[model samples]
Target: MNKKLFLLLLTVCAFQFSFAQKNLLTDFPKGYTPEEVGKRLAYRFLEGKHMLHGGKWISYPETFNWNGALQFAAKTNDKELVKLLQDRFEPLFSTEKALLPIKNHVDLNMFGSLPLTLYQITKEKRYYELGMPYADTQWEVPEQAKPAQKDWSKKGYSWQTRLWIDDMYMITIVQTQAFKVTRELKYLDRAAKEMVLYLDELQRPNGLFYHAPDVPFYWGRGNGWMAAGMTELLRCLPKDHQDRPRIMQGYQTMMKSLKNYQMPGGMWNQLIDEKDYWAETSGSAMFTYAFITGVKHGWLDAKEYAPAARKAWMALVSYINDKGDVTEVCVGTNKKNDKQYYYDRPRHVGDYHGQAPYLWCTSALLEKDTK
Candidate 1:
């Protein structure tokens, strides 16, 4: 072969080899295993102990980070890590009433799942014991409460009577966990009913659920929460339950629409509809986790969804920097009016928000059952 042609072929092969290594579905990269990635994130949480904001730390929406750490600990079986979680988390319990101070449905959902995770790891009833009252109260919210109105508080947040896809994760998944812990059929029943309500009320004509009905936004991460939440809820829900089919149908409908929005690079943008929307990493990671988990657990068809999951995983890995930090995560936002509102959101690299989903997606993708 001519020297020029030989060099060109070598370059092409090298590029393909490099790409394959970075692609999580095709091959596991040498430097960062799922466990290592998870540990690094856990370490960050440890270092930032007091600085971590949200339910487990401060009472912020992003406090959902604790759930991510708990997931990593359970999957990796790192007892010391689990102990650290218990230490940090136990203090957050409200001693006055002996109940978690979950003021809103969203916090109730995020922190509510933690006790169940603690129970899973330690099998200690105390972890889940405190959550009982709150779990019981959640069932009391009328199945048909008018959708929440969208009125931003002084802190640039809004609430509405209607369900948003985000609430599925923020609330329903935790409710499902509570059901699993207590084995109370009511918890599952209420979760299923609420999930169906969101599906019925918020799902757009295009098959994707709107981010918020009152706000009329359809952000990708918002939908990611719904997809992941449903997958988690389904894992614990009974197979023969009547509500199972409805939930599955909702997932299938959303997956169909998601397939169309996937970019050539694999990541979805903040605004999934606009071609110019820059691909986002956090939402992409969550979607990949939910889709891959669904396929593995038989909730979704592997042959059909795996390709999309793989593509999103590949794009997600590309966002990881040399230091093993995941980047380009879109910042948290309230409901918005137009595509530009989503597109203009700032992006950050190596944020804990992004790291959680990265760990989740990698773990889900690399699971032997999925392959």
Candidate 2:
């Protein structure tokens, strides 16, 4: 072949390969870009006066939004956004200390994730001092723990282990945040071990999880918790980590199941396996987050998963109202055995449960984000 022709052919081949590799971040339409969507969501989160629905102390949904907003701020290097979020935490030092959650339950302890994120960005000692204890206490066995809880603790699990699907994200995020900042192996190890056990006990043969064993319903956000939890864990879990294989397997399995259920409009149903159920925003966003992270990290096949992720993102953006609140989010729910309990849950607009995961998906889509 002629030298010039050969060089041109190689250049064309390289270009084709580059296009073949899915870019989950860009190729978005106006108002749906990660930067725009993330800023809108972060500012909206900061502007809100209250995140706790009626609880005296801040709960997981609110903390989850705070943590995600902080990450978005840090990723975008939005100094103003970071400062605003940090200032919100100021009252916990004194005036609103009572509003701070206690270290007893997984949901409460997960509040540590927000301050720890602030610590990572600002290197502030106050945030570190307040946050580390919550992560640590999660592993510390309590005297009042039941026999089964005691057995879980004997094997180094938290006494708070209730085998609920929601517990995985609540348990995983705080520990993952600790590990990310402290470079501590114990936090990662504990989360990984707990994740593996959850996979064994709760993950059904179909790769979807029941809200709990007795519930036997694949509630979307319940599975969303497991999906997002595994994605967060795998992001930090080392390639050679002992539990990596099992965690990866569970993540992949759930993702495949999730992929099959993604609607043509890219939203997932409130009951993931029930096509007749309503399209849900929070769970849909959460699943999109997992898909985006998995594709970005090379844990999932990019060509197949990236489009699904992109479609979900675009579809989620359509759900956001003029006020930046995510629509059709299922209200905070507890596990009930009856399928009707899940089907009948009210969907709210702008609920923190719905708003939180959108920032997560946006952050995952940012090209420069290596975290």
Off by over 4 Å in 1: 1-26, 49-63, 93-100, 141-161, 322-324, 366-371
lDDT of 1 by residue, 1-371 (tens): 99999999999998886455335354546544566566776666666634233424343333456667777777777788888888877666554233345445554435556677678778888877755655555544444444443231221222322366777876676677777777888778767777887888888878776777666666878888888878777877788988999998888788778878888887787777767777877777877888778766766666567677776765676677766667888877778767677878888866666777776765565465622
Q: Report every candidate's CA lDDT.
A: 0.68, 0.89
RMSD of every candidate to native, in Å, equals: 8.6, 2.2
Error of 2 at 253 (Å): 1.2
Q: State which candidate has the highest lDDT.
A: 2
**Cα misplacement distance, residue 78 of candidate 1 (Å):** 1.7
- 78-191, model 2: which lDDT tens digit per residue? 999999998988999999998888888888899899889889999999999999999999988777777987888998888889999999999999999999889999999999
Which residue pairs show backbone clashes in model 1?
54-58, 54-60, 147-161, 147-162, 148-160, 148-161, 148-162, 149-160, 149-161
